[model samples]
Target chain A: MLILIVEDEKELALSIRDYLKGIQDITCDLAPNFSKAVELTELYSYDCLIVDLGLPDGDGLEIIKKVKTEDAQTGIIIISARDTLDDRLKGLNIGADDYLTKPFHLSELQARIASVLRRIRFDGKSILKEGVLEVDTVQRKIKVNGKEPDLTKSEFNILEYLITNKNKVVTKASIAEHILGEYSDMYSSYDFVYTHIKNLRKKLVELGCPDYIKTVYGTGYIFETA
Target chain B: MNLLTKTSLLITTVALTVLMAGGVIFFLSTKEMINKQVDKELISEMHFVMRSFDNLVHGRDTVFYEELTIIPTDEIISPVARFRDTIRLNVFDNKYHTYRALFFGFRKGGNNYKIEIFKSLIDSNTLIERVTLVWIGMSLFLIVAIYFLNKLIFKSTWKDFFEILKLAKSYDLKKPHKKVLLKESEINEFASLNTVITQLLERVERDFNNQKELTANTSHELQTPLSIIRMKAELLLQTPDLTSEQVRLISDILATTDRLSRLNKSLLTISKIENNQFRETEKISLHEKIRSLAGQFKELIDEKGLKISMTLEETTIEIHPLLADLLLVNLLGNAILHNPVENGRILLELKNNILKIANTGDHIELDKENIFHRYFRQSKNPGSTGIGLSIVKKICEYYDIDLDYRYRNNLHTFILDLSSLYTS
Candidate 1:
């Protein structure tokens, strides 16, 4: 998959570029300004674009609008520091597939990018599989080696969020945000996140799946298959 | 009373006093003048009779009253005249009428004789009554006319005052220029008032915008650096191999960065709210809101083994929905954040128009001095930005809701009186 990251901040753009390039199967390009973003979107036929809503030259929503008309199949994800609902709606309304707030885990951004790509190319499949653990999101079912695991709804959600952003550190707040809302980043408490994560790990271990969920000691949870 | 009414009262009091006093003085003086005329005529007749005393002595005796009898007195060293007021029977209607009479004593044909002369005073009485009636009618008309005149005159004269008032009331702080809203009054007092008010509003608006600018610039400028630090710490976590202590230290760094990011966002949110930037409002259910947040925090509640009771009735309020959600999150999130880890109790009740939230927490009172201040934390957690309650207070202030705090027996209660915001 080819992706374009349109962010003005040099360090943030470079970090995101490096992270995406290191994904092994994906190629990423960086644009530091709105004109460059427009120029790149016009010249290339990328599978997806990651945008920041606030850019020095122009708004990132304008780029989403420009690309959406040219190639409707290309997925777009908006990452912004202005996390208000109004800003989120505007990005979505302008044909962006997903939105992420800033100071977010790059892992969360990666998960959102993956989901957008899957929706475009994978026949919009709701099922996610990490090794022998498989989840049918539409049916809310979890299966392990042709057998189902007795996971509660809350436990299932936590597992799904963790596995989607696999191999990257996802904050407990991010997990809580998935369960709660965008405001959960501010309102998160450690105790509740630990309870959910603990139950999810216990359920997975009982089902004979590899212990994929790792705690980042005071940071958050990470799901990996190494 | 309003200015017009007050002025009319003072003017009317002075006017009535002067008119009433003038009427009394005129009535008395007019009566004296009439009496003088009557006395002069009586004295002239006495003079005519005295000059023609021989006539009264011989032929003019019939000019006296029908029952008059001349009396001789030894005490008449000189001729004397006196007047007295009396009631005399009206011959035509037999109603007693007021009469003022003059008596003159003189020596006639060597005998001291006295003659009493009276003119019926019915006309005088009628004249006095007519004068009094006119005076009373004029007093009422004069007072009433003065009130109405003041009402009409001041209303137009003070149009500029009302305009200034409206300008002051409707000035929007977010709008850059407001000098055009108020006009210079032609009246000196109001013009001075206009100048002073304009200067004051300009000063206040400048101060307010400076504060907003400082908050916005601080938050926005800090975001990129904070983002860089946070992303760098997050990137360092993906290191190939690190000791346990290194991982723990990096994790703490990440957590601190994350907390700092949230603090920046909170300051920005507060600045926007204080600027009244969120003018959009919608009707939303309070009960559903609290229920949804409770569901979100259920895990946290269970983790602490806290007992939370929520009794929500069906009620809705017209508010900026985002603000409403923030209010719920901060208040309830604080409840969860501050609850004791063991046997913590939280009760949320929506009774009447008040949202009463009580929780079991520190036995001693939280710092009451800076409880609602930003960054003045009450919890042991050093990461507390203390912006949560301040945000709650700001939202409450925006909606004009009354927020009260009470602590009793180790239970702190927050009551929000959104009484008037209820629509159903």
Candidate 2:
């Protein structure tokens, strides 16, 4: 997948590109200004565009509009420091696929990108199979060796999250956010995340699958199929 | 008293006093003029009588008086007269009326002849009385007319003033409104009042906005660098064969960066809320909203071994749905975080437009006043962002919703009364 990150902040944009490359097999480009971003979008076909609402040259929401006017199918994600509901809604209304506030976990951005790509390219059914583990996106079910396991809604969500982003280090915060929605802000500790992941791993291993969850010592957990 | 009432009272008193004084002066002046006229008439009549008497004595004038007295004593060589006011009998009307009489002593033909002549002063007296009465009546009329005219003119003249006063009274500094100036009147004072007040309000709003901008920008500008620091620490933690002390330091750095991110986000949230940035609202079912939010806490609640109950009815309310959700989440999280060590009980109820969330716990010993302030942490963990309740309080204030915290019987309850919430 080819992606363009339209952000002026050099370090943040570089980190985001490096993080994405480390986690997934994808090529990324950076545009430092509105004109350059527009020029790049014209010069090459992109699978997705990461647009920042605060650009030094111009308002990036207008860029979303301009880009969508030319190519309506380019998946756009808005990464902004403006977190108001109005700003989020405006971006979404203007053909942006998702919205993420700044100072966010790169893993959260990765999950959003994957979701947006699946939505735009696959047109709905997003299934994943790694070794003997499989997730049916349409049925919201998980199967091991063609046998389904009894998983609750949150358990299912967590499994799908880890399996899709296999081999990528996902933070505990990102996992909580992915499963709990906005209620993730209420977490005072990650003990709940540890318990949920332990239960999910037990359920999977009991159904005759190898242990695939790896903890990165001081950091969060990583789902490894390699 | 109010300005209008006080002015009317003062004006009436002054006008009445002046009218009374003028009436008294007018009556006295008119009485003196009438007396002088009466004295002049009496003198003229005495002269005429003396002339007629002289004529009769010389045998050249016919005189009606047939009786005369002569005295040869020498009291005066010329005529000496005295005048006295007396009431005499009127032969025509048979009613005694006031009269001015002139008595003169003189020597005629070497003998002193005394003549007493009296004329009626009834007509002059009646004229003086009538003139005094008319003056009093006119003075009273002028006083009443002036009072009414002053009242009517005052009300019409201050119409613009009252309008500007009303606008000032209703103006709120917190929620600024546009078009603060009234329609400019032709009067200079009223127009000046409108201009100054509008300019003052605009200045206040601009200054408030600038301060809010500073807060928002400062918080927003900190996010990128904090993210960089946090991500770098995260990347460093990824390297292999690091010592325990090294891991500890890098993780500490990561933890501090995370805390900073949360702090900055909270500050941004507060500024946005106060700036009236979140304006989207919808009709949301309290039951469904509560259920969905509570379900999100299922894992934590279960892991903590806490019990929560809900007695909710599906009442729909109009509010910013996101804020309503946030309010519920914060309150419930507070309940769980503050619950006792074991067997904690939480009871939630929504009845009669009041949302009551009661939890079983020891009294938190919160300062009733500063509990809602930013960075007020009661727990010893020192990890609490300490801004959750403050944000909830702000949201409640925005909606004019009444929020109260109380502890009794070791049960801390947060009550939100939604019935009295007003939109306008």
Candidate 3:
């Protein structure tokens, strides 16, 4: 899967690219500004697009609309540091799949992206099942030996994404962008992703689900069926 | 009701009263003196008649009567006769014998003889009537003269006064070079008044222009740096491989940008209030406004672990909402911001057209008089912009609202007298 991040912050874009590398078989591209972001959008097709609101040349919302218009099938999420309720409502009203305020956890972002993908591509159905380990995406219900186990929305989404993309590495940036949406701009420090991943892992282990989501140190996450 | 009309009316009333009173007194007293003179001459003629009759009767001389008749009686009685047509006389003998005497009187020598003489007072009355008529005519003429003189004084002086007044009313600061044209009056007071007014107008125009320019320049200067800071933050976010420290720095920049924006807005608000740019009327509920402000600041209050209590009486007050809001915001925000953390408590009470907000805080360091001065923040408080209380004071002054601040037992209380809301 390919993901494109068009942001004016070069450091933030690179960090996002680095985080995506941890996800197996996933590639990422970066665009540093409005003009460059526009160029990248025209030249590439991606599974998801992360767009920031403030751009060097123009407004980020304009770019998001243009990109969405160009590729209606692409899943777009807005990331903005502007936490005003009006800004959030406006971004959502303009067909953004999710709006994220700044200073958010990366794992939360990853869960959101997975959820969006499942909803759009897989019709929110988990196709990966092994014996007693069955993940239900539509209901966010997990079944171990035909006994349903309770899961939070974040936990269920995290488990489902890891299982669907088994034997692959998912970077912290991808996860952060997915859950935190545009808010990752505020958390450019990249430390919040560790806590959310840690929590998700601890929950999955306690539930007796397969422990496949792994932290690739200094990079991202990897889910293995071993 | 205008000054000129009022003053001139008063002058006319007083002048007319004095002139008419003097005219009446002069007419009455002059008539009395003329009557007294007529009475005195009549008495002297009566005496002369008695003496002449006595001589004639005693000497038994018929020549005395003839001599008296040749004495030109017109001279002796003309003054009285001029006022009367005829003079009548009566003579009484010792046995009460009576004779009708004309012009003069005669009497017997040994036998007691009494003589009485009277000139016709009808002519005297006629003369007195003529004199009164002339006196009244002269008085009328004098009153007319005095009235015209008063009118002349009022006309010249009032014209100049009105001209100065018109110039003052039409004075425009935008056209400072246009001099108020006043015809120079000989009256020193009016001339001096004109000079003073012209000087005052010039000074006012100068000060107004200077203030406008200062505000314009200050606003421009502040806005420029604010814009630059915002743009710089946006640009900084675009840098590659930014460390965690760099990210933190950018966040700081953004926060400062927000503060600067707020400052700019507050300054603009103060300027607007100072210039009286807002309309003077609005209907607002003081209770509802305080409730709304409390709700808005609820989070900050909660975060500081402060307990807030409110007791508001139901009342609908009318005032300018902008000024009222500004006043409330500053007072409440100040109370919240200055209070000690965890120990902070606010008591908001509104009743009897008074709003009192009290909060726990450090003791006020400065004298109360300096509290409302611009940029006069209390010592040892770093977070305050100092302009908040000043803005509150200005709003109170403009709306004629009374604001009082007091500190007691580590509690700072601000009282807003909303009495003007009802009266205005």
Candidate 4:
């Protein structure tokens, strides 16, 4: 899946790209400011969009609005250092699917991406099937070839979201907001999302499901059927 | 009550009293002196008349008697009966008297003679009387003039005082231009007071703004590194064929980053609360809000296997919704985190604008006074940042909500009095 990150902070943006790259087969486009983000939004089609509230030319909310207007189908997530509940609510109210406070773990981000994809693709469906592996979104259940498989909720959601998105790249911010919810914007914290994702991945491997979630370095995740 | 009015009243009252007393005393003393002088002159004139009688009877010397009559009697008796120009005379004698004295060619006699003398006094007394009247009138006028002058001075200064008060009422730390324009007072006391107030207000505004800016800048600065750490950890986790120890190490890094982020957020929240920066106000249902928060934290509560019971009253209150949400989140989060396993239980009750949350926990010895202080942690709980209750306390103070904490029988209870919320 293709994901676009619009942030002015070069180091942080590059790091986010690299983190998502480690997740799965995903392509990333980076925009440093509002003008660049607008240019990219107008030029390319992305499965998901990650935006920062503070931009050099304009506010990130405006960009999110523009992107939504351009591509109503594209999922938007706001990644900002503004961790206030009001900021989060405002972003969400403006049609951004989720909000990630700054300083989020990449694994958590991946998990969030998986969850958003699951919600967007499956709506409220309980079971998500991709080839031989099937994930139960609601009961946190997993199965491989119709056999019961052990998987934590985090793992199941991640696998389910990726499988739903299939070949689409999901950004780190999308994953973070989905798993951590409003608290994902906290820059120095990643424990909740990271620990859950680690446990989920471990359980998924133990359950003998083929590891389809691939990482693209410096970008995000992609679920490919081999 | 004001300074000028008070002073003017005091001066006018004292001056009127003194002037009236002095005027009465002068009038009485002048009258006594005139009466004494008149008696002395009359007695002298009687002697002169007796001396002239021998001349008149024996030698027929009328000029001597006439000269005695011309001797000034005005010093002894007033010549005017009214406040205008007029002159008149009269003489009386005892029935046994053989001769009498008269003026203007008239003779009257029989026993001893008695005479009354008067002359037009308008010309002589007019200037003195007018001068005295004018002096008294001027004194009264001076009293009123001084009183009003003082009032005028005080009114201007008092206006400045009111202006200062008004400026203080609307003082905004965020906007320094909103500060009052202080005028220099002619009164030393008022000027000094104004100076002190202005200085204090300026210092408070500066300190508050500095603290706010510091929190915002620090939070922003901290974000970049945290993001970098999180991203690096994700990159490491994505490495193919990572050993267990490596995975654990990466996971540990991620956890540390998460903790740091939480800490940063909490610190920022505390600063915001302290500065009273979050001013958004809304009407919210207290019971419904608490229930929603409880639902959100259900995963944590269930993980601890704690049974929760609630008794909520249907009431709506106006407050900053974020503050209310934070208050509940911290309290519930703390209860869940500190609850004893297995048979742990949490009971929440809301009624009469009061909210109570009680949870079963290990016995704790704490200094109640210090519990709400920032960075104060109880001896047994090392996981707490010590700012949760502090934040709650700040919210309560800002909203005028009352909060109390108590522990009894292995149950920790937090009571919040929300009466102010209802009133507001």
TM-scores of chain A, one for each prediction: 0.87, 0.93, 0.69, 0.66
Looking at candidate 1, what is the lDDT of residue B187?
Answer: 96
> Quick one: best lDDT, which candidate?
1
Ranked candidates, highest lDDT first:
1, 2, 4, 3
DockQ of all predictions against the true structure, Cα-based: 0.37, 0.40, 0.05, 0.24
Docking class of 4: acceptable
Model 2 DockQ vs. reference: 0.40
Stretches of model 1 off by over 4 angstroms after superposition: A123-127, A185-188, B1-184, B365-370
User: Considering summed lDDT, which 10 consecutive residues are worst modelled in model 4 chain A?
Assistant: A183-192
Where does candidate 3 stray beyond 4 Å? A1-226, B1-192, B237-240, B243-260
Scored by TM-score, the top model is: 2
Best by DockQ: 2
For model 3, residues B1-424, the per-residue Cα lDDT tens digits are 9655666567667766776687678667865675666556756765676657555445543333311332222222322222222333423222322222234323333333333333334444566578767866776676667666767777876787777778778775544445566657677887999889877876886788678657745764565355445444544543445565765676566555644555555566666665666556778888899998787665456656788999999766777766777788788878777778767899999989898999998865446898998778775554466777888887887767888987787778988888887742
Q: Which is superior by TM-score, 1 or 3?
A: 1
Best of the two (3, 4) by DockQ: 4
Choose 2 or 3, whichever is better by DockQ.
Answer: 2
Expressed as tens digits, the lDDT of each residue in B244-315 for candidate 1 is 788788878877887888888989989988777777888888889899888878767777789999898888
Query: How would you order the candidates by TM-score, starting with the best?
Result: 2, 1, 4, 3
**Model 1 steric clash pairs:** none
After superposition on all C-alphas, the RMSD of every candidate to the true structure, in Å, is 6.9, 5.9, 13.3, 10.6
User: Where does candidate 4 chain B have its weakest 10-residue lDDT segment?
Assistant: B97-106
